[model samples]
Target: MTKSGHDILKDRLRRAMGIDLQTVGHNSLRNAVARRMRVLGIKETRQYYELTERRAAELDELIDEVAVNETWFFRDDTPFTVLQRYSRNWLKRGRGSCLRILSVPCASGEEPYSIAIALLEAGVNGPLFKIDAIDISYRALRLARRGIYGRNSFRGRNNFFQRKYFQKTKAGYVIAKHIKHSVNFIRANILAANLPILNSRYDIIFCRNLLIYLDKDNQKVVVSILDKLLVDEGLIFTGHAEPGAFADSVFIPAPYPKAFALTRRSAVVCKPDRVSYNRQILPPSLPVQPLWFTELDTARELADTGQHEEAMECCEQYIRRHGPDKEAYFLMGMILTDMDEPRLAIRMLKKVVYLDPNLVKAIEMLALLYKGLGDDNNYRVFKQRAGRVAARNQPAGKGSE
Candidate 1:
């Protein structure tokens, strides 16, 4: 008996591509086969499936079409936040060293470009830093190399980066020369048993928001491969929503404050002079985080409209993105305090202090909020801490306001 068209498609797609049409759902599979058949000039689905089975290269091309490719520049904030922090510190530590990064499933190349831009922003330059980007689609790779997109791509673009990083042309907006030069985009399938293009280790691997589409087992396999590619003492950045995907290893969350990035825990984690990661039970008094003002302005507007709920939610969203700034928590605390939610205000202000120990205004407001809630002990403690920190960080003639 001759097999049906659907049967052939299921078998060829599964065998040739490791893509189980059964897992892809029958309806979606049917649509994809139909699309490919029309493009391939196969009069019938059976003929198309037969072609794919007989032709390995055609099968590879078809697989690229079926794979997911949806992405945008700076799609999530946390990973970029992690990138920014690591670049500053790493450049300080490993000056003149080659810092390499990989962007898996780098759909259409915008992501890799963004990472390159981030590296530039963090002051990595002069041939010391490099980026290795990959994607499954030759089609997407072509577009990425062009480095030109509609000016609308810049609309509502919360980053002022492009104003400095792009040049206007009849060909559209070309990426700045520096960003374009730092990155290398290769086209390859990440799901394959082996990756030929990426044989070397990298300082960072940004495989964000891509694994959620895969089956559980495939997700694990891909993650394991990515983990292997990451350098010891390197960093990994992913989506906040997909944290459960990587609930393993010494992959503790790095404090991006507002964004999400994870640092690889080496066998021996080093200690910086001012900050000690080990033997440190001290309260977090680090600065709130470097603020990316372009994104911050939107969150600020959300607060001005009395959309406290949305304002706070936006604040939380921004925090998960890696661009944590001290002002975010302070804004949130002010909203709660105004609403007479003193308890929440005190808690939020505590976060501000951890982020910026010398955030005197936060301490003052927090003390008042605590006193309103009958928490005199906290009010006194915060007040004293604020006084001492102000005196310490303050200029000799300057006093705490």
Candidate 2:
């Protein structure tokens, strides 16, 4: 059986960009190819494929279409919180004169901008830190450089950052000049032989959601690249589904819950300096809460660091004090899942869903738990419910993952 021209193009794309067809979907490849073909007025697949082989610029255009550019500011809030804490500690230690951070596949600037905002909220001024944001897509880079964003860029419950950092105009909100100046956006592929930042090492790197889209070999390649680019005690933040890619590497999960941070196994743990909690760093409009509320965060940190027993104890203590809080139950559920206690995790997750029926994460967790437990009927029920909840919660014009 002979492979089609399209199939060969897929192979080419994989080699050129390390994209896993299974992860990104064949439809995306086909759509990108079709789009490029339409632009060039090439009707034949073989003809377009030959052109891509000869012309690197055409191939890059195809890649821009195929790349997923869906992102919002502070997509996962925990990572920024962890970054603030880490930055505070870094400032205290004074290891380096300037803190260096990298955001690979920065995706239309939200992430790197969010990083700037997070650092600013942590009292890290422009002179004290440098952010280098990298992305392959020229289209995304243009938008990032423009530094103006619409509603789609600002999602989730916390919108106070918008009020503090953005000036609303008729043409969407313009990011603060200070925040824009803090980031240096670079257009380059991570898989390139001559990566722009090969000579540079970073104290922190946010390479989230990229590994999940790459093949096993490419995942390893990326991990190696990250290891080389990161300092000994540096932290790397990854997407929720991406940690498994680093299991065979020297990277270990950092003690930060949903932050999805990893550090080198040989990295020395830096003790945090004793600093008073600053309420201003959090959401501006949020009312101050009791100190005991931080127990759940501690539990999550413990769980992330693989202290399952202690995490469970913390969750239990929180539950005893707070009387059946949804957040505590969710944390307990995750901890149980980490401990390989699926049944117990399912029970906790069920309570979380009961307390807040619209909690999609808890619902999805239940679905996964049921599937793991070999209960197909319950799995389907929860999976469908999770889908419904997600659809209801999702904002308009949001791209599907």
Candidate 3:
């Protein structure tokens, strides 16, 4: 049988750019392709597939559709806080002549710029540090170079820094010239054989959240590259959902909050709250009740669909019946989060983490909730825990939802 248009495009994309369109869901890929076709005035699917191969510009556009570029300045402030502290200490000690930071797949430059702002605010001299930011998308790179962002990039309660660093204009908040100059933007593929920065070593590498999109083999490849890019004592920071992928690597988990900083194995130190969530501790192999699992699923669906009260009720019933069920409590916490009750949500989520410390999502949400409440210490602590658990529990080669 002839392959469907989506199947053909999916295979082509997987081969060309290592993107699994099917993994993102068939409908999403189809719709994106349809939109691209409409924009390019290509009515026939077969011709568009050929165009994707023959025309580099067209292929880039399609790849942009698959690329997830959702990011904000100081998205999770924990890492920046860690960076600030580390940079200050490093500078004080005179350990390195200059601090070099790399932000791969930098996603419109929010991260690297945020790093600049954090370090500068930390009293580190602007010229003492340099940031090299790279992304696969030219469009995103263009925006990053422009250094202007709208409301989408300015989120959460931390607008103080934004107001300090950015000048508000009709288009959006324009990043200060000094911050923009501190970061050097480049366009390159992470998996390319000749990555632009392969010869250089960085004090810190922010390869956050890029690995989830890759398959298992590619994840390994990307990590290997990052390991080489990092200086012997330098750190690599990842997303909350990525620590599990580094279990066997030479990187040791750094005990910083939601920073997901990993150091060389030889440099592992006793971090104050070094989490050990990788130990697979499942509830004993006793036969699980199907009905209870079904209720948990129902509650999760309800919460996801914004039926917070109904979900909470379902979770409450489960907890009452099962006696502090981890999943139930976690669902309750998520529901509370939807209901805008951060304290209650934190209580339930903390319970969930205590019951099963490897509940990655619970720990992550707790971090966010704490951040909302301006509890910096707890926010970083839970964020770090979440990264460890996420690294342990995340399946190989799946994209972020």
Candidate 4:
């Protein structure tokens, strides 16, 4: 192996998972590498690197373990909300036809399960719709098949899922057979030169939070392939770090007030409970950070896409140096919101308006926080600011786009 042991490991990772350790933050990358080693019972990075470069039959297992497949049920809340709102119209139009849904990078089935939950809740059932859940990780696929979960994995979902969809099983909770049967699970790599599914055929594709980890070249390749995988009128969803990749596509953005989605002309737009924000839309990332511009964009994106913890570290670093930019406060508020710390989000947003009085989104978000807290007086003020922003952002009498 002409490459250094570390370099060889990076190459194998790039080949299998599209992860470049040189670019991924060293701490996160090292920990992730260590995590894979733990899974494989390797004692150190050197051995792991050696194994990674060997191309032995063990490559598959190692690749699966290293892929940082972090996921959960109802992960983002908005995309599914958008889907839930749109499903009614979709069902109404199709009348009796089956709706085909696909979730690529479906990691352990949470996204597919989320789709199932949304579709079932929308009252569109039976043969009328289907979800094809696919992933590259055989290990992840195996776990998806198991359908068991820990209390912490989805701590509060027991009651809702119990009431809405699942039943007690020999292995914790299995999604009701009806729900399980609604999906066809396949262990497949989306980046394979050819995808098994027909081109341009799915109605909705939930590939959220998956593409950001890939290199830009890979990102473009995947987007082009997904454009083909998506029906002319199908919708494609990506993560907060990834909204930029879709800007030039044939897909038209149907950014609902609260959620994220892009639709073909025939696709329906849904009105969510509240149109919130998502993603940083910056280009590229680096391995380390002193809060570089790309890193700010990444943090802004992390905060934007609702991955607040990852985002907070970036914003907090910026704040430590620059002393409380309103945008930093706004980003901080977003992280707090994702953390389910609405009171904290309120405090953070308050700081945002204190720093920049004209920060409309901060005001609107503050209103939402107050509404959550049942402070109607505060709600009205922030709501008015939101309305003003909305009015100004809106075109006059449709004279312009």
Candidate with the greatest lDDT versus the true structure: 2
Model 1, stretches more than 4 Å misplaced? Answer: 1-26, 151-156, 248-250, 265-401
C-alpha root-mean-square deviation, candidate 4: 13.4
Q: Candidate 2 lDDT, tens digit per residue, 304-383?
A: 66778877876786677558877777778877887899999999888988888888878988999999999999999999
Displacement of the residue 183 alpha carbon in candidate 2, Å: 0.8
Off by over 4 Å in 2: 1-3, 273-401
Q: Which residue runs of candidate 4 sit more than 4 Å off their true CA positions? A: 1-3, 22-24, 27-56, 155-159, 168-171, 198-200, 264-401
Judge candidate 4 against the unseen true structure and give its global Cα lDDT, from 0 to 1: 0.68
Q: Tens digit of lDDT per residue, candidate 4, span 1-401?
A: 22376566667667766655545565554566677778788786777777755755566766675666778777767677667656766765554667788898888877788788778887877677788998888888887777665543463333366556766666666666676667788876677765677553777888777677788777777777777777655677777566776767666555342345666544434322222343322122234432112224546545556666766776776666567677677767777877889998898889977876666667778898899889999899889887877677666786355
Per-residue error (Å), model 3, residue 85: 1.1
Q: Put down candidate 1 lDDT per residue, 244-355, tens digits, no spaces.
A: 6667755655433345566654421222123221121233434444322222333444455565675577667657665665666776777686667888887887887788
Mark the regions of model 3 whose C-alpha exceeds 4 Å error after superposition.
1-5, 268-401
Q: In terms of lDDT, which candidate is stronger, 1 or 3?
A: 3
Q: What's the number of clashes in each of the models?
A: 11, 0, 6, 6
TM-score of 4: 0.61
Global lDDT of each model? 0.67, 0.84, 0.76, 0.68
Residues 147-187, candidate 3: write the lDDT tens digits. 98999998855777977899999999999998999999999
Index of the highest-TM-score prediction: 2
Give candidate 2's TM-score.
0.70
Q: Give the range where candidate 3 is weakest over 10 consecutive residues by summed lDDT.
A: 271-280
